[model samples]
Target: MAAVKGCQFSASLSGSCYVMRPRLHRFSVKVPFFDGPLRSRLVSLCCHNPNPDSFIVDQTVPLSKNPTHLPDDCPQASASSPSSAIDFLTLCHRLKTTKRKGWINHGIKGPESIADHMYRMALMALIAGDLPGVNRERCIKIAIVHDIAEAIVGDITPSDGVPKAEKSRLEQAALNEMCEILGGGIRAEELKELWEEYENNSSLEANLVKDFDKVEMILQALEYETEHGKVLDEFYLSTAGKIQTEIGKSWAAEIHARRSSRLKNKLN
Candidate 1:
């Protein structure tokens, strides 16, 4: 009996002879022998093709080599390709173009897109102070992906008629799809984990990032009111006196003071 590497064989009884079939490599072998142990004859079984079109399997066939070894044009060979990353990049473009509907519904013209909001929140995370034992890098990442699912589900405001649980379910599904588009590597897993953390609001980093989120929104609202001269009192009211972190509270307080002075000056 001879054992061959990279190939497996099984015996089938046909009439009074035994037939041996290779398990893979898109080729078959028929050996006819009697009821005695055969020795050393099953060698030289290379399915290496001399011509490309010589072998065809109708069903899903296991390859003798790793799937990555297939020719460049084969789809399985491109399974690990960066094309999926490109698709995710393309999807992210929507984040840059889709305006935060909260502002749009309030009639704020030329409102900031979701990416604009995340960018400032990420910057806040970068310069965040007094976060003892907190991971700043992870907070930045959480800010970046915190609203990423909105690229697919759009920004669901509290008054958007979407139940909180339903909105979370939709956003979670969208996040999974986006992560899959990135081909599910370590970076994708990290972003998915960060996004889940933000969604859960369970960690110190997530708590701080949530504060950054509200602070950024209010900051944007303040800027919009200053530039456009439209009193966005509702925006101020939404986040007023409710910021969770000391940094967020201080920033919100300063913004409110500036807004109040501007209103007083306007009245005067």
Candidate 2:
């Protein structure tokens, strides 16, 4: 056996044979007993013990023609290939171009796009104070994905004359299409789950993100009112008493106080 070290061996037993090649760190055994056109199979054996007498087979890996090649079905290998990633990002360009219909309807010049709204909501989630039973990171993720479907649906608003159920259906279908565009791997599945969670208000993070959505809207409204010198009373009225979380209520109150002070200053 010592003389056979670092050498190949071929032996026939019961009409079957194996070829063994020994190496320093690993070795491979080729067996040719299969009953198909595939005449030989390679089994890789990892060498753990330094001493040959105490050699132990640590792992056995079956290899195809190329030893380092991964199968086509490997998840990590196929997840978000470059082409698919580019395609998905190209589809998302609409989010950056499509302005929020609410702002556009108000005749505001150069309104924020759907991506701008979601980005501010994400920032709101990021800067929010810690709350018990709330996952801040998940809140950020939820905020980012909350309006992602608008990339396809183009930010459908109540004034669009579409029913609530119909709007939801359109958004859901758009999200599914977006996921498919991303090639449907772990990340795609996660995006779908987060979007659904926000849509259904299924968790504390979802609740907090929902509040951030309203808070972001009202905050934007206040900024628009100050910038455009137009009192957006309807925006404030719609969000009044609708904030769910304590943080959201406090933020909304502060915005309202600031708006009131601005109005008084204008009067004087």
Candidate 3:
């Protein structure tokens, strides 16, 4: 199957249908990069659009008509419910806006988009939970919902050094806005409590999830550095000291040592 802006398509010898596309294009580890396609220029092979509205799916993938492509597990979106129209996953699927006139994004590019980042982070929290103790499911739920507000507010990198008071204000407002999607009440309260727990690092789970957050960044930088060069190591180092938990600290050291050894290997 060939990939255009996002969709992939293939039809078989016996009239079989295949629609698997590379949904994870964002996870590139290659360099010598080139420009991504312009949205208007994408071509859909064997796909027809006599009128712009004829095709429901965006040129991008997950290839379902609904934006999020309602997982087989997700309740089928009712045609009547307009709120279900929002496609969080597809929005996340689109690559970050390029910051400059180059291949990579500057402001919020490498950092995973809100939904994408949260999904992986949640999975990591669940999978990499501190054994014999912390509540992985609770931590995962927190990580998942933690940054849903970011879609509206945009990524606020920790390094921006925004004042804690201002940041908290912005975050609270963002959360309030998102809770509106579900009509906040006791249900929203539970999610907000989890967010607070994470923000305050009040629980072992929260602290662990926080570590996963940093770990994800470190891993991303390492991939970038791998494709680019050792020059990217500085990015990793900058956040290393900020990690609070022992696990995060240990992981940072391992990443550092590995980076150093890789550099040495290249030199040799």
Q: What is the C-alpha RMSD of each candidate to the true structure, in Å?
A: 14.2, 9.7, 18.4
Model 3 regions lying over 4 Å from their true place: 1-111, 129-132, 158-161
Candidate 3 per-residue lDDT, tens place, 1-268, comes to 3443443443231211122223222221111111233111122233332222323332332312222233222222213233422443334333243121111343324544455556667777766636667777888888876665565556665556788778777978877765565444334556578878888888888878888787776776666667666366456766756887676777778887887888889899
Whole-structure CA lDDT of model 1: 0.72
Between prediction 1 and prediction 2, the one with superior lDDT is 2
Model 2 residue 156 CA deviation (Å) reads: 0.7
Query: Which model, 2 or 3, shows the larger lDDT?
Result: 2
What are the models' TM-scores?
Answer: 0.69, 0.72, 0.57
lDDT of 2 by residue, 44-128 (tens): 2333344454334443334332232322332222468788899999988889999998998898899899889899999998889
Candidate whose lDDT is highest: 2
lDDT of each: 0.72, 0.74, 0.54
lDDT of 2: 0.74
Question: What is residue 224's positional error in candidate 1, in angstroms?
Answer: 1.3
Supply candidate 2's per-residue lDDT for 129: 92
Candidate 1 backbone collisions, by pair: none
Q: How many clashes does each candidate structure show, in the order listed?
A: 0, 0, 0
- lDDT order, best first, reads 2, 1, 3
